[model samples]
Target chain A: MARKLLLEHAQVPGINTYEVYRKHGGYRSVEKALKTMSPDEVVDEVKKSGLRGRGGAGFPTGMKWSFLAKPEGVPRYLVCNADESEPGTFKDRYLMEKIPHLLVEGMITSSYALGANTSYIYIRGEYSWILFILEKAIAEAYANGWLGKNIQGSGYDLDLYVNIGGGAYICGEETALIESLEGKRGNPRIKPPFPAVKGLWQCPTVVNNVETIAAVVPIVNDGGEEYAKIGIGKSTGTKLISASGNINKPGVYEIEMNISVEEFIYSDEWCGGIKNGKKLKACVPGGSSVPILPHFLVCKTANGDTRMMTYESLADGGFATGSMLGSGGFIVYDEDQCIVRNTWNFARFYAHESCGQCSPCREGTGWMEKVLHRLEHGGGKMSDIDLLVDVAKKIEGNTICPLGDAAAWPVSAAIRHFREEFEWHVNDPKAAMERNYGLVNEKVNA
Target chain B: MPKVTIDGQTIEVAEGTTILNAARQIGGELVPPAMCYYSTLKGSGGKCRTCLVRVTKGSEKDPRPMPKLVASCQTMVMDGMEVASKSDPSVVDARAAVTEFLLINHPLDCPICDQAGECHLQDLAFEHGKSNTRYEFERRTFEKIDIGPYIKLHMTRCIMCFRCVFTAQQLCPERVHGIIHRGDHAEISTFIEKSIDSEFSGNVIDVCPVGALTDRTFRFKSRVWFLNPMDAHRDCPTCSGKAVVWMYGGEIYRVTARKDKYGEVHDFICNTCRFHTKEKGSWTIEGPRDLDRHSVISQNHYEHGEKTVR
Candidate 1:
């Protein structure tokens, strides 16, 4: 029974409708923000809330908002990144589908804070049903005077539109999403002129995640200080964790960031304690891109402290013995699943989704995917393991976008924590082909 | 002017000069290699990681180093910035990795390719690449596609540098072809197979870093090592008409834009000058192109001493 902000009304029936959402105190932030507070006051309150972007990067949202350049006579934009294409991350989709008005309300308030005349929600193309839901919600808001020209007589004008993406994972990246919105190919632009300075047809722009913008509603309604008191430290406020993979209750759960990782995975209210009483082998605490943690380090840190679900606690060991709370894609792995095969699957996704702008990502992603495929399919050599690490290292810091690092991390982490598993595949090809390498008993090379 | 130190050599450049340009101003071995960055073409660079350099110190105001290696071709030179190109072992390793990535799927058909003697990729492979490749997967291949009567699009040889796309948008009036699909499957395609018939369309062949785009008229004509390149120009209404005429036995084999020491074409020649007007008597010769003594074209031809080639 933790505090739920974004998803408090998620389970309410008819929450998708404007009237139903209005009766339940929806869009209160819009009224409070536009009526009482000035635009800069809203930004100040958000900064006080200590809210961070729920996207994989975990950058501070208020800090990101402050970086938006305010050049006179030049229009600034606030784009909602509804393109939730990351694997095992479906909380945004769930939030939008269950309570679409929450996002629309967030868009209106966030846009007012940023002084944007027009805003956009660039949603994933695969979520066509949710797109329809969001579009309907936006239309409902415009009809009720919550959106568009002189909202509730505040004299602050705003118009919000929903744009659908072409179902590519790279479009989730801010610059690539901007490129796709501009009716062009989804190649990521090189940064120096970041999106905050020159974005969206050469104007200042701020792209916030769906959950990040929606959370702004609560930050506005409850006041930043009230919201800041919920979660622990800098990880203030409740976060939506999209739990999946070998969990009995594998659904999106809203938890305050103060809970321990053991409580989250084993509690009856949360994941319902890994499916069928099976032994948990590992976990990718964040999304697929973050490092994977073995069973020994999942519930506790390498320093033998209780691992909380906060950002600092999850990343306590910094990729060697710790992982990130990235996008909150808490995926659990049972003993039966093989790390090598899973790593290869993620590699294939990255290779397929890469925009092919730069050389390392364009070629190296596919190269790693092919090498991992050979290893998984019983045609690997022991030397292939080190070669994969070398290639992944080369691609980590050398691309036009983070997609290169995203593609490289899973491969490197798999081999880093589970080298014996990879070597097992290389050493015993026939046995590896027949069945997966079951759970390692004693952490052979960890 | 900004004073930026690259590889321990400090130089002052103009207000908005890039790190790559600053290094080029102090030209020598430290000037990073560029495959996609054509100086004259707007919005061309940063797509090729070949020119990546480490900024050890960001600027005089912000002394913090950049978190990652940045593309030097696009990064502006901040005052008191310290950059490491060939001087750092890490930069060298990154360049070698980039070179390897660029060559994994490249059809190593330099023996038959027409851009061999002066290819930027050839020089890069010689300098930064390993002797043998580690890629065991089947190399990507594509059928030769002729974009028009003059330019052949050899998609397999492309490194996705985007130089030709920038060239088409900037130099040519209408751009018909661009990169289609994504990732490793991406190719330079005309989509519905439309012929690029613009007057300045032939310049795409020159801006291409590899043999991806070549003069269709000169396909398989001869290896470039045998033909001596001579600087020549003609007075024409459409363009500057300054070009290099590749000649063998007193006959023009192929015509191309005259590239600078960095292999960038500043004066873009038109199709009429490049494809249609190829004769020994069409223009005044400006002597054998001052071949870099280190260039592969100058290997055997300069043995008779640079004076006999013309």
Candidate 2:
């Protein structure tokens, strides 16, 4: 069994409260950070810990913090990205609902390190219950003097507030979230004046994921080198993976990054294998946006090396046979599930959620959805298979935001790996309408 | 000043000049077609994605190439940056794809539309788009609405360029309409169907790149190709009154702001001069407006002195 850094006391009675969390050694990182370490020292420790963001992008958090432009007399900010609206990813909600103080503590320590006098936690609007839990924990922290002006007489002033989004998936993007925070429509701003330089009302800001900010507590509580020693090379420290779909025990699990993918799937401590003794067909190891890997490549790399639950191991084959460990939303598909229907469903989500700012994502996503819908139903042509690929390629790299790529990758990967399934639909639309292609090993040579 | 290269043509521009503006400096075929970017309107570009150019080398300091094609309207040029616009086959292909995306939902009703001859989208499609569309789905449509007494809102042809919204905000004291909803369902709408009554609201018709917003007084009056656009102006208390009056034989059809080659108006005309004062006696006509020989509006226009208008 691996050590649990985040969820060790998740099952403890009243761990959501400030008293029980403090008894379990919470806020010690805040004290250690504010009283003993300078802001630059704290930043140095985070940089040494090799901690990448647990967000989908997996950028190094330390480098992201260092990029916050510090012009004198101007206020800097640390924004917690609690807008966990990605499909198949609910680990942030689970962490906040289970232990809210950890995130509040992280916000304090991270705000101190960034020299931000004020901070905000932009949470998803759908998590209203979790918002209640977090607010309760934040009130408790303020009552206990862990938050607010000059915490523990350390001469550092901080104030943290929580703001909820209006239930849009694009708000999870940093600039869109900042726009929503400023009481405007959630259209993503064009880049080059990144949020690190000018964000949140033209102030320098750093937006970190919920888990990435929470991990700063552990990096400060223990030394950076000690935390770095827990996981594989470069994928240091533990991660919270929100496991769902076709699994026996579907829940969030904390795994040190050294574990193998097969062990995590079949071991009783984790997902406990596929449901109902069914054979595994495919899996989207990351969230819905990442490429879907076939069953053969799920447990081992294309070179036959055992794939581990790390950033480098999962992305070893670079979209040919490999996938990313994106947001750790491990989704498993059994033999009975249809890949074409799933791809269409995701396309519909992207089309519906597109902010309509850019042309490609605005029109191309809906066009792909209509084509995929036609292919899934009985109204598809033989030429529609290549047409889908062409449309997805056109939209991939030509948009103002990454939403275009996210909408394009699933369709491209679905046809790349599961071309046979789509061809089966096109070859015999009547049969596809009646039944699904179940667990075929080889192509039908249509 | 920053020096940049577009399609192997090198030019030095003022510091903070965008790549699209830089391409315009070396004019002719090098300037990429821009539908949403109007230099006069603030925060108008980057949504259309028609002017995307590849940066082969990022800059002198960071010589690494940008991984993806960037919207040239929003990105500023770093010194020694090399951009590939028409020179790269990928940019041409990308512009075609973007043209298709813009046309898929757009109702291509150029024959009956008032802005047909002067429409930017019509020219963009003729140059960069495929002859036939591959989209089999039903094109989206909306009802014609009268946004004001002077302007008609044809929602079906709007590409969501947001130029009109910027025009209202920057020129009008109170903007009554804006883009509402989101995604493909997004539309420029007034709250609770309120009519736009601003004094300067007629300018929205000029800023529209398509026939989405047409002049209500000039609706279905005549095709722009048949009218001769002459440079004309009048002195008014509210606005500059500098405008181009579209004239037929002894009749003034419509009056609009004098637009530059890029279809941008430097001085905005008020509603009184645009709609109410369309008469030959009210203004001094300053010859025929110079039209680009390549434009559809200049098809039968005698550039010498409107000799054919008997």
Candidate 3:
């Protein structure tokens, strides 16, 4: 298979090394961008390529770049929002760890394009090993004159720094990320002056996800129109999805944007179908934040359209059936697994990460957590099931950021698709408890 | 500027102004529920379904909007857009449903809630919500997790507004408060197990739309309907965020946040006001010249004719 942008050198073993990366055509984009393409040309090329952010939002990357405040030469910043705290989304870690130079090269090129002399990679703190790898890789780039001033004597100056996050999901929000970078707590700023306008240090900034920036390297090398032709319709590009949970081969797979859900799941080239030959019960097509699709509905959607990976196709019918390609965190559920319990896990994650800024998200998350915990562990009543659905609906689209909606989607989706699971827990507490604890033990053993 | 008609009143507002704000800009006959929006903070948190309004006229494609009751907090103002807040059936139904749903798990501890007087829950309940819940189940409960010294928990009374979380972002520089879980099972929790240790942790108590979150020091001291908030400021070494300490029986019982004064000029309080800002009535009435700071003047110097410690 002719691997496109993401998988071009993805199969190359030990590409983490600078020499191996160089051999596989890395750092060429930075050299090309600085020595040849003007910053404006780079932006125009990206605009033409129609490259959207891979960080869940699917915002147009070039449009986001165009939003920058260019007041005739004020310092702009290029911040790589590597705070990949989104649950089930682990594509960036593989890319950054496998080819650290790829990110650095991407950052250098993107920074130059955004008119930024300084850049910072904000990595989530859990990746200590990745942190060390990046630090060393950055040192290598510095030594090779690729990161520091006058790289390859092109007279393009750029500096990069890595900021360690205190482990916050809110920091992933651009403005909140800027606040954390400014040495404050990771809380989202009220937007009006989005980061592109008055970001990091009150200067114009462009915050791109790790995968988003890395994608830029390829966009520049291959012509924009050529890159655009790979994917179907508006979903123009390959996506690296973190396919975990109940799958035979639970791994990150980079598939064309138009690949079907069935192909992505059952194809040996991707998830390799359900584990232990289990029946598919349901699937959270995107990240935990997107709505969960029931096996019946998902199959219907998949059967009706064998090509449904793009933003438009995946969300073709909105919440009624479709799910979002948020951060490409694809989690599948087998028939035996309880949807309520699975949703509770996601609820627990969001409640933990909520920055406690707003009441609905803060208070509602807690309320939902307690209710879900009760329902899952066996103390819940029938009305509790209704209450859970009600609370989930209340929390959805109600808070400051998508966090509220993120919290709401899984609960609402779980109840909508599998209220029977929660009813089983509430109606037959002992059996549900037995099932839940069994899964917990199974998880531990696995 | 866009010419928008809110209710029956025709008005003009700056472009990009949300429909809710536009209605608020020009006094409208239709009462739109703008519960989650705080115009002070640039367009946010349309979580509360209260600000929902029906765009009954103008614009053919959206003559009948999908949501039917769109959150006016999110929908920006458009030219010739007509909003039906009071008369709209869908808006009323959505609001009533939202309020009832919000109040289902919320405890009946409002009599003792510090936010009872100024709470959106209380106002919305009487105005838009059903008087009683059909839910015949045990309300969702948390064991009143003590997040920090500054903030208290009463999980039974929460309504899940993002105001506290948003307030933490703006008023407090640090991340002391945030949501912990997802969906109906989500909870507002501190980072890891650490306390909500922030300079502006008290604002969380104030911004908590409901009593789910409360001030620990003032718990059970005074109900919101009773204690008159005496306007005051703290001369604490760190923050000057106006500390409107609550007083009862001529004695200050709680040193809570004064929301009116939180702005660019002042209201940036730190740990000093949060922890050490005690009631002035608690003072011993003695100078620190002769003895220690807490030393009180003796009755010998307290005579009507006698001079006090100077």
Candidate 4:
């Protein structure tokens, strides 16, 4: 079995409670980090861990931490992004719901490293029940001398609070989260004054994802080098993947990053192959935003190498044949699935979720959704296929936020990999209306 | 001051000046169209992608072409910066795409609309948009909302530029209206149907780039082309005491905030100056000067030589 860092003790009885979590060596990283290591040393250890963010962007977590500006007398903040609104991504929710103290322990260690006295967990509003679980765990941490001021005679003071977002997917963006935290609408702010420089009430802030902050516990406890030794190459340490869609086991699974994609999908230990023993058609390896790969490309790279679930391996072909390990949202599509309908569904989600700040995202997302809806329902033209590509290209890099690109990638990838399926929908309107274009036995376009 | 070259023309701009402002300062058809950016309003721009320009070379401080097209309104000009606005085909294509997005859901009721002649979206579409549209699907529509006594919101015309929302938040001491809902359905709405009854509520009508938010008093009163705008001022205790009165025939039709040559409102006039102080006895009316070159009204009327309205 893969070494499960987060969900190792998830199935233990009463693990959600503070007592059980503490009994199972939960906050040991906090003790090690606060008592033994200085803030700089903790940061250096995290840098050595090679831990990239588990969020969709996959930014280097330690590098993001070192960029936090420590102006004299200014209260720097450490915001944990628990707003797991990305489609097919529920790993953060699973971690928090099953083992809330892991996040609490990680937040304390990360806050101590960044010299942040005040920390907040910005959770999505739909996860309201999870908030109570986290709050109870935080209270337990306070009672156990982990969160309060001058803990263990360390002369370090830290306070952690939970802020519930009004359920905006854009709030997952750090600046937008900061805006929402400050009691404003969730519109993403412009860059250059990044959150590392000026954020959250004009103070320097470091916003890390729930999984990124949670990984710090293991990094500090086992030593960064030890954690780095587990996974292959730059993808060090175990990652929690929320596996769903056409899978027998549709739940969060913790796996070492060195596993091959085929092994993770077919082996009994992981996804256990497609549901009902059906043939694989396409798979969105990361999240919905990443490019959808046909079954052949999902198992192997465009370079004919066996594809691994690591960041470098998954993104080897760079949006042409390969997809990202974004938020570890591993969604599998069986032969029965329709690419046009699925792409239209994703477009609709984006059009509904867009903050309407940028014209490309606000206007273009709606246009793509309408176009895709027309194509899916037999009301499409031959020119509309290229028009979808054109619209997606226009929206890709034009908006202020990544939501534009996220809304574009799925449609472009669908058309790139499965243009024939779209043509099938357009050419035979009566047949297309009756049934989906099932899996083709032919090789991928690449 | 940092020297930047835009469209083969080089000019030095003050520190912290945006590329859009610099291009406007350089003049001669290089100025990028900005739909959401207001020089007077803070925290505008970046929402509208109409001002996107390719930065070929970064400043002396940072020598790297920006990875993608950046919003020129938000990007500060740096030393040795090279920007391609109207001269670049790619930039022009991007602006055209933005225009298409802006017009995809627009009601396009130019005939009956009060802002028909003086709309920025209309002018941008004429310059940047394709002759025909590719969007064959149903265009989005919204119910007309009377947000307040003075404002009538035809949300179908809103392109979600957020200019009015920012204007309301910044100018009104008590802000009640803001953008609500999400994506294409997102519209500027008053909280709990509360009337946008602020002292400077009518400034939203002025900041609106389209006819989404129109002054109820001036709705369908007269086309903007027929009205001759005259510089007018009043000694009101509430505001800056400056405005432009749009007069048709012998009576004043509407009064709006006076914009400078760069199309920036000199002051965000209150409702009293914008709506209540339109009477002929309120201020000293000066002879109608030629329309400021940067104003949207001027761009619409530029084809016709300056006609003396008096």
Best candidate, DockQ: 1
- Model 2, residue A213: what's the lDDT? 93
Per-residue lDDT over A1-446 for candidate 4, one digit per residue giving the tens place of the 0 to 100 score = 67888889999999998889889998899899888999999999999999999888888888999999988999999999999998999999989999999999999999999999999999999999999999999999899898888987799999999999999899998899999999988989999789999999999999999999989999999889989998889999999998999988888999998999999899989999999999999999888899999988999999899999899999988988888999899999998888899999999989989998888898899899888899898889999999999999999999888999999999999999999999999998766666664323222332
Query: TM-score for model 1?
Result: 0.97
Model 4 misplaced regions, further than 4 Å: A436-446, B294-310
Please list all clashing residue pairs in model 1, or write none if there are none.
none
lDDT (tens digit, per residue) of candidate 1 on A212-265: 999999999999999899888899999999999998899999999999999999
Lowest summed lDDT window (length 10), candidate 3 chain B? B288-297
Whole-model Cα lDDT of every candidate shown, in order: 0.91, 0.90, 0.74, 0.89
Q: Determine the iRMS, in angstroms, of model 2.
A: 0.7
Predicted complexes: DockQ each? 0.88, 0.81, 0.11, 0.81
Model 1 DockQ class: high
For each candidate, what TM-score against the reference? 0.97, 0.97, 0.74, 0.95
Q: What is each candidate's fraction of native interface contacts (fnat)?
A: 0.92, 0.79, 0.08, 0.89
Q: Write the per-residue lDDT of candidate 2 for residues A361-427, one digit (tens) a residue.
A: 9999999999999999878887888988999999998988789999999999999999998999889
> Which window of ten consecutive residues has the lowest lDDT sum in model 1 chain B?
B293-302
Model 2 chain B worst lDDT run, 10 consecutive residues? B301-310
B282 Cα displacement, candidate 3 (Å): 21
Q: Please name the candidate that would achieve the greatest lDDT relative to the true structure.
A: 1
User: Can you tell me the DockQ of model 1?
Assistant: 0.88
Global Cα RMSD, each model? 3.6, 3.7, 10.5, 3.7
